[model samples]
Target chain A: MPTLLEIHNLSIEYKTRLGTARAVDNVSITLDENKTLGLAGESGCGKSTLGRSIIRLVPYPGRILEGEILLNLDEDVPYENGVVEKGQINLLQLDGDQMRALRGKKLAYIFQDPMTSLNPMERIGKHFVEIIKAHEPDTPKEDAQVRTKDLLEALDILPERVLDYPHQFSGGMRQRVMIGLGLTLTPQLLIADEPTTSLDVIVEAQILNLISDLKDKFNLTMMLITHNLGVLAETADSIAIMYTGRIMEVAPTEALFESPQHPYTQALLQSVPDVRKPDRKLSWIPGSPPSLTEPIPGCMFRPRCPHAMEICATEPPPLMKSTSGGIVACYLYEGS
Target chain B: MMGKSITISGVFIYLRLVQESFRDRSKLWWIVLGVILGGTIALVASLIILAARSNSGLGIPVVVGTILFGVSMLVVGLFRTLLIRKGTFSPRMGTLFLVGVTCILGVITIPVSIFILPAGWFDLWTVFVMGGVAIGIILLFLYSRYSWLKERGSPGFLTITGFLMVLSIIYMTVISYWIVPYDPAAINVGPILWPPHPGFPLGTTSLGQDLLSRTIAGGGIMLQVAFLSVLICFFVGVPLGLLSSFRGGALDRVLSLIMDAIFAFPGLILAIAIAAMLGPGVINMALAIAVVYIPSYFRVLRSQVLTIKELPYVEAAKALGARDRDTMLRYVLPNSLPSIIVVMSINFADAVLTAAGLTFVGLGLPIDVADWGWDLTFGWHQLITGAWWVITFPGIMIVLLALGFTLVGEGLNEILTPMLKE
Candidate 1:
């Protein structure tokens, strides 16, 4: 199967008061259709930054130093498959107007805080209408309204509540409303950044289920950015582990869960509380992720890695194909 | 409290009834009710006594109508705590107690005014009215204390009370016009410094004209000048401020520089310059005052606009394809209104004062127009002698009316400032 969305060698930085913050550094990932890729990282590990970079939502001062977002729309065209077409476009090369045109139709985003993402003054129905109107203004207003009402009903919200303002809805309902809005366009790839972080456990499960269901229904290639290992284990088909703006490992979910090669991945797995193994001591990942402002001489996790050696401090590990089904960027896993 | 099931629906129903009752009461109807029962009787009895002394039935209806309107307004106001309320007055015993007390006070004041002021016990009516006003102030103060302690955030009652008092004073000024008939400008070569009489009420000016006529005419001039100047200032200042804030480049710098230069100009001196340029008249004086006020309004609006411009909503609107004009007008302009309203009021009072000062210096209107400043100009000399009412009345009127505007502006500011609202 062809890769649906390819982000190659992406590096992003922003100028902050404390000097240049290397938010995302040299990250690469390819997501295939009907596959779920989880960008798992702790806070400040550039997971959100990487996700935002993919969607081109970086506000200001944050510059994409080097990258190309290559989205494969050719697969949808019957005759263009496996052909090197002329005038192949990259997303970064597109202007703001072009980006906006492509964005809700081909690319969509699920923000973490749905409350702030939405206009508080407008009704939920109005928000959907505006999104549809922006991309497809020629569509009749009455038609858009009906479609949005139907989408709201599909998302388990009452159609009567479509006229209610953002303030009238509960947080979970708002998130669902947001998710419905993001998926209403049926974009090729959906970038969801911590979509369930703000929801309760039950609501989180419902939302995750909803996203997964919609992913299959829409045949969406989803890039789910999250910190929760359990969430990734449940929802994502594949996982890319990140540590301080760099991907430490990428693999199929079950394989990675069974045998996590990267030291950081191993430490993350051990930290998760498991009810099946009640006697096993819950492992703690000692030390914090490396500060992005300072340059890492070799491995960013060298200070925290339990099996760190002298060479690990000075020489950065290159990502190599491991036997178990994926890639690992670790000196210890060179033979795997 | 004893046996009531105070459900949400019950509370809601009670609140609805209270709102309905408040909206149903008309200000005119309340005033009419007050006149038939409260102070009109006293005015009629006084009119009869005055008729016996003068042996002339000269427009008793007009005098009665004026007194009826003014006194009944107060009587209705005293009762408005119950009758003219807007929101829920939930059947609290404390509210009932307040209503009862106001009714008692209104009843007592009626008989007291009948038996007191007209019987050469003027001090009694003064004391009664002052006492009522004092009690209102105290109640307002107590309400403020409660609101502060309760952390309700807004001084809502205090604002309404302040607004009521200013409104009443403005009503008083407007109603006073009904008592006079002769045009204030019609020259009278009657005896100068004539004492109070039926023919020459409020005595005569040094010009041998009715001071009452001049006072009435002067009020009209002051209002016109203030109204016109403020309107012009708003037009010139608000747009310029919005322009500077939204387009912060060379255009902004140029607008700011011009405004600063204008702001640096002395108000009186600038009035004098415009008056000198255009020649002294009400129109010229208003133009000068408006010109001087523009800079102040511009500075205030520009600063407010700049602050609002930084807010995220502006960017969000821009991102949503809201045209620059649409964003500035819809988002930035509406948000900046409170500050603009506040500044305009202060500038209005300042405009009035400036016009008065210019006229007093013989630089505003021509010598014939009965402006408050002109009245003060011509009346101040009479002050050195024992003709104290000449300068005092017009001066007091200017100061008191300006104070009324200030109070109203402050009250409005309390309501308009979203950050300050509860």
Candidate 2:
């Protein structure tokens, strides 16, 4: 199957008070058509930054130093032209006006913090109408209002609730409103960055189920970035394990969990306390990830990796395919 | 006993909060307190000065001594904050100084009032000399403490208060005319420039007329200009600003450009130009002042509108298909109030000063008229010939009134702007 999206040798940097910090370095990942790719890492481990960069939404002072996010739509397939064109456009090169056209129409994002994303002063219904109008300016006002009502209903929000302000809605309801917006245009790829982080556990489960049902209904391909291992196991088809600005492991969900090849991956899996088998002691990674400023002398994880050896301290580890059916970046897996 | 002590401690804590709020160092409570205290003292001293005309009374030196004490309090309030900022005085010490200022000013007023009584009702020469010395001492203290207080109170407050104070003093002068027997412009060439005596208090002006009556009548005219100018400026400026911000694009740009051009020139020059064309009167000066102020309000409203317009809810409203006018009026304007108020308070002061400036420079209301600016302009000449009462009294009144308005405006701004409180 052809790759739906390919990010090759990507590196992102930000100019800060404490020198240039390399946020994402040499990260290469691919997702096939109709498949889900989960990018998992600790907070500030460059997971959200990667999701934003893929959609060309990274704010100022940080730029893609080197990389290409090639989003190749299957051109021969006959699909809704709007959804097709949304995923087909080269977002990195478009100017603000052109990029704006892509937002809410073709390519859409469900931001992490929904509170600030919505305007506090205006009615929710009014915001919904604007997104439609911004993309389809010539659409009659009556049609836009009707579609807004339909979208709100689809998200399980009462149509009357649409009249309320963003502040009036609860955390869960706002996230659903955001999801409803992304689904309105039926965009091909939905980039959700921890959409349920602020929500409660029950709300998180409902939101996850909503995403699953909607993705299936719309046949949407998604890139879900989250720090929760459980969410990724349940929703993601394949998982990319990231550490210190690089992908340390990438494998099918079951394969990565059942038989992880990298030491870091093993450490991460061991850290999750198994409720079914309550006797297991949760293991920690022992030390923090190496700083991204300046070049690390050797393997970025050497200081923290229990399996670190003499050679691992001098030469940076390169990712290699393992016989166990996943990629791992460790000197022990070099020959594999 | 233990319970009672705890209750007492809790009560003390509550009282501290209230006092701290009202007497906040950042809010410049001392200056405000000082001004209020000083004004009360000055009013009492003036009355006493007039009332003492009948008795042998305190001499000019004694009145001057009282004036000096009040002046010191004003100086302390103004400079106390500056002294703290510069490390010359710690905050606790500053508070002590403020308390001292209030007490001292209150004390000094007792004697100062005796000299302010009507001439011959007291020793008239002694009252003048005493009042002059007091005012001089106050000015000297304020000058010395100027830099210190500058760090404490806002210039915006000073600006507004100064303008209102001058207007109030002028109004009092006009009202004083009503209290006296003669009109300000009344011709009585016979008893002109007769020096201080029982019936013709404050002696005669260079016009050989009753100075007291003219000073009293000038107050009403000043009231008319101050109130009218502020009203016109607010009425015109606020709406023009709202319209420009809402319409934006070409209209916003044009409104801003026109306003910028008007604001570029000195306000008095603009008023003079308008007066020259419209001919000299309070109405023309007011119209000119209104035109100049429109741009300031427009600028404030425009920035506020821009911030409120971009909020997500704003987009939601647009999405809901709200008309632009409805969105602006119902949403944008209300949220932008604190800023609008801050600007208006400052502008009120500006309008007053601009009107006074125009009048003083001969581009506004004429000098023969009974107005504060007119009184000060002609009265200053009398000050040179040892006829200090002619200008000194009115000038001091203007200064005190301006300071009062400024203090109030400053307090409001400080309390309203959360960012400035700490």
Candidate 3:
């Protein structure tokens, strides 16, 4: 499969009253067409920030300082000046109008909280109509309405309930509506930013299943951001572990789980309780993730790493290829 | 030729559409009612015209009979609708009927008193006392059975009280010309500084103007200035506040600085200064009061806008490709309006008081104008002469008007703040 999105050396920082907090440090990621890349991290570990930067929607006080988010697969390259020979278009270089044009049609985003994500004042059908008409101006109202109805039906939501306000629906139903809205334009990339964090476990499974089914049906490349390894294990083809605004490891889901290389990944996996092995005590990593505002000099994970060395305290470990057909950022996997 | 045919066919088509819309069995009653109403109006209008043409003694009875018949039919229709459709008497409908009747009586009596009554048939105080009693009866009925009165609890009671006070002032303003025993501006109508008499009621002022007439007429001018001033303050302050908060940084800082400078002074004193500079007129007084109140509105609305702009729904709007203008108007403004309304209501009382103060200091409208402030200035001298009615009436009018607005503001605050929280 061809690479749908190639994010290279992306950095984002938030200037606050305290100081400038580096939310996303020189991070790099690649997502192939029809593939699901799960981004897993502890809370405030910059997974959400990285997802937002993909769509250039980092909220106030947060700035994307430097990055190259090359969208290689969009059919129409409206601006010809910066198109590479390989047909990759850098999203960061586009102006506001150009970015808006690309947002709903080419790259869609689903926020974490379903309660807050949907506009309370607007009906569900109106949300779909607005998004459709905003991108495709000449699309007839009847066509948009029909499409919205069909999409709602596909998502297992009652099409008749499309006229209902956001407050009328349950949390899980609202999330389904959000998902339906995301798929309205049928974008190439759908970034799900902790989409199921605010739902119950049962509803979370259903939403994840719905997302997986939708992705396959539409042939979409997805970036599923969450802190739950179990959720990633079920839905993601590949998993990327992020720590302190940096990717510590990236591998195929099975490979990363079976032969975890990075200490942070290993500690994270150990913490997940196994029902099959009841005797195995759940092990947790000591100390919290480093604060983004006052980052330590060396590897951000060194203080928390059980296998930290003197060199780990002085220098940040570079990402190196592992024998397990994946990359790990740790000294232990230096020559492997 | 083609244009004439098209126009004829267009009229036919429109008529057909209207017929089709009323074809349903459910809609037949509406058509019947419309026809009945149209016929009644035509009959009454023709009778009035005949009366005017003939100049006969039969005209008065015919006109009165037609009006009474129309009124009876309306009452019957209302009852029928209530009993048939709702199967119960709704308190809201009852309140509406009462208010309608009151308005009709006011309309009838005001014109009749102005045009038909002999100049000295009755003292102006008699009309005022009668109107007050009728209003009191209606208010008592509302207090007991008005649905919102029960639903809104204590705030609702306050709202009704405020509403009634304001209504009385409006009633006085409207009927002032017809009900005043003498024209408020007419000097030497009686002996100067006379005690309360059967005709004068309140007494004669220093200029021998009827104090009762002056006080009633003064309400009209007072309400006009206060309402206009509050309206100006609202228009100037709300938009500026919304714009400043939405487009923060330099614009916001400048607006805040300007507003603070204005706010730093005592409100009445500032109004007095502005009123003095603007010169004496009703418009000038209103403008002065508006300037003093604008800062309060600005401060209230700016804070509300700032908080609302940061809500998740606003960010969601931007994420959905909503333009800056759409986001501000659709999301931010609607959410912030309740606070603005509350502020405006609260500032109304203050604006009235400020305008009166400016006038009392001889900076408001000219002394000849029948205004509460001008009356107070004239009446103050009579106080030492034991002519208490001169100052007391105008003072009471000012206090009552201010109290009415204050209650309304407090009531709205109580009702709106909780709704915002929800």
Candidate 4:
């Protein structure tokens, strides 16, 4: 499959009273066309920050220091001149207007908390209409409302309830409404950042199923950022395990799950209690992810790695091919 | 212990009445009957007092008609009290208390809104009477239909009264010329310092200009200044705040500092200085008052923007490729509206007052113009001479107008505060 997006040596830093902390290090990721890429990590693993940065919406004090977010979509090339190179567009170089034009249209993003993510004062239909009208001012409000109804219907929500305000909807319905909003524009890439974190298990399943169906329907290249390994297993085609702002492993879901190469990925997979294997004891990785405020030499996960060696401490391990048909950043995978 | 229940709020007393009356061995019908009886007696006493107070006695129908409506409210209150005593009422005593209190408030506003109009202005008097009756009926229907109307989230007495007060002033301002018996500026229209005698309602000023005509006409210019100044402040300050907070950095700091500098001065003193500098014209006075109020709107909107922009919805909007303008207008502005509304009503109250103060100090329209501030200031010495009607009527109009805005502002604040949890 052709590469849909690629990040080259991306670095994001957050300014603080103490000092600027590097939240996302020189991380490189390649997302395949029409494929779901899972970015899994613990909380504050810079996954959400990384997801926000793709849309150039890093929260205050946090910024993209250096990165080339190449959007490889072959479409109308929504760029002026300099940002486009040989068909692909470097999103980082686009001006405010160009970058925003791609948002909600080519690259839409959904947040974690559904309750607070929708504006309380605005009705669900109004939210859709505002976004549609913003991009296409010629679209009549009624026309937009018709499209909103169709989208809501697909999400299993009553289309007639479109005029209802955010507070009127329950948590699950609001999330569905938000999803409908994201899908209304038929975005090329939908970055869902912990989209089901706040929802109950049943709603989460329904949302995941809805997303899977929509992904096929829209032919969308999705970036699913979540800490839930099981969620990634069900949804993502390929998984990229992120630890301390660096990708420790990148492999197909089955390859990573069946023959996980990176110790961190193994530790993560072991921690998930298996219902099928009743005798298998659940495990956990000891030691917290290190503070990003201070620089650390060599592997970011070296201190937490059970197989920590002198070589792991000497220098940061480069991502290399592992026997599991995936890339691993652990030194133990060298020449594997 | 009883005093606690009787504390300043009449609502608490109503609640105490219901709870205490429950302890009485009287039947429900008897209790309701007693309230109707009491209301009749009170109505008779007010009629006697009003009938005796009327000098020409021709205003007896208007007075008698207004009091009869007030008595009908006592029946409405008893209906609500009994409704609350039924299971349909929310178990919260606050809602029950609000129902009883609003009934009392409805009755109270009838007298207060009525007394302000002199007996002779039949057209003006009838409009207020009809308007009050219409509102009371509509409200009674609404309150009876929806028990949720008594919820804490609902608008309270102050907001309702404020709406009436403000609307009446605006209505009076609009139809003043059509309704006024004489031209507001027409001198020698009545005897000087006349005390609301027949043919000369609201008495007459020292210049023999009709005080009722002057008071009614006075509203137009004051409202114009208040509305214009508020418009200017809203246009300038809201944008400044929105831009500063949304586009924070040097702009936020610089704009916030300028607003703070303006806010640092005493409101009246700043208006005085500005009005003094600008000199006396309607536009000039509006500009002067606007200078005093822009900082308030700025501070309010700026802080609101600061808070709202941080919310997830704002970030989500940004993610949707929304332009800065869209994010500000669709997301930020709508979310910030509650405080904006509160500030606007409060600002209007202060603006009109400041305009009057500016005019009082010889800074508004020419002295011969029929403005409340000019008439009040010019007629101040007449009050010392025991001719209270001249200053008193005009003074009461200004107070009522200002009070109208204050009530709306505070009432909106109470209603909207809980809705905006973020």
- For all candidates in order, the CA lDDT equals 0.68, 0.66, 0.75, 0.76
Clashes of 1: 0
Better of 1 and 2 by DockQ: 1
Ranking, DockQ, top scorer first: 4, 3, 1, 2
TM-score of each: 0.69, 0.57, 0.79, 0.79
lDDT per residue as tens, model 2, A175-273: 898888777767767888888888889999999999998888888889899989999999999999898788989999999989998888898999998
Give the distance in Å from residue B209's predicted Cα in candidate 3 to where it truly belongs: 1.8
Model 4 clashing residue pairs (backbone): A104-B320, A298-A316
Q: Per-residue lDDT of A1-336 in model 3, one digit per residue for the tens? A: 899999999999999999999999989989999999999999898999998887788988899999799997557623223322235788898777777767777788888889877666567898889888777778999999999999999989899987777767889999998888888888889999899999999999999999999989998999999998899999999999999999999999999999998989989999999888999999999888777999998899988888989888888888899877888888887766
Per-residue lDDT of model 1, residues B124-190, tens digit only = 4443444345335434444434332112122233234334433333433343333344445556645
- Chain A vs. true chain A, TM-score per model, equals 0.94, 0.92, 0.96, 0.96
Residue runs of model 2 more than 4 Å from their true location after superposition: A73-90, B1-341, B357-422
Candidate 2 chain A worst ten-residue window by lDDT: A75-84
On a 0 to 100 scale, what is the lDDT of residue B103 in model 1?
57
Better of 1 and 3 by DockQ: 3
Clashing pairs in 1: none
Q: Write the per-residue lDDT of candidate 4 for residues A1-336, one digit (tens) a residue.
A: 789899999999999998888889889999989999999999878888888889988887998989799887566634433332335888898788778767887888999999899887777888998888866777887898899888888999988887667867889988888888888889888999999999999999999999999999989999999999889999999999888788899999999999999989889889999999999988898988888887689888888989999998779899999887778898897776
Task: Report the error of model 2 at residue B341, Å.
Answer: 4.6
Give the runs in model 3 whose Cα sits over 4 Å from its true position.
A16-19, A73-87, A119-129, A136-165, A309-315, B1-150, B419-422
